[model samples]
Target: MLILQSVAGLLILPSLAWAISEDRKKARPRIAAVGVVSQLVVALMLEG
Candidate 1:
């Protein structure tokens, strides 16, 4: 579980960087939402 969480965290880093680099201001919110959902899914999957 800890390993999964760590891997999830690592995976988010590139998405975060991509979000920051995006010139389309509108896409940021979507990217952030995806990131949040991804974390929640991983957490729930691990916890349950």
Candidate 2:
């Protein structure tokens, strides 16, 4: 689970960078949503 979270974090990095650099304005909100969800998942993983 920890490894999966780390891999997800790693994957998000480059995609986030591209989103920041590219013209994908619509993707920003979706990215933010994913980030929030990921944080919640991580919290659940840690607490459990």
Off by over 4 Å in 2: 1-27
Tens-digit lDDT string for candidate 1 (1-48): 988877777677656676678574555666777877788798789899
lDDT per residue (tens digit) for residues 1-48 in model 2: 986976697678757776677567646667766876787798779979
RMSD of each: 4.5, 5.4
* Reference-based TM-score of each model: 0.45, 0.44
Residue 35 in candidate 1, Cα distance off native in Å: 0.2
Off by over 4 Å in 1: 1-27
Q: lDDT for model 1, please.
A: 0.73
The Cα RMSD of model 1 versus the native structure comes to: 4.5
Question: Against the true structure, whose TM-score is highest?
Answer: 1
What lDDT does each candidate get? Answer: 0.73, 0.73
Clashing pairs in 1: none
Weakest lDDT window of 10 consecutive positions for candidate 2: 22-31
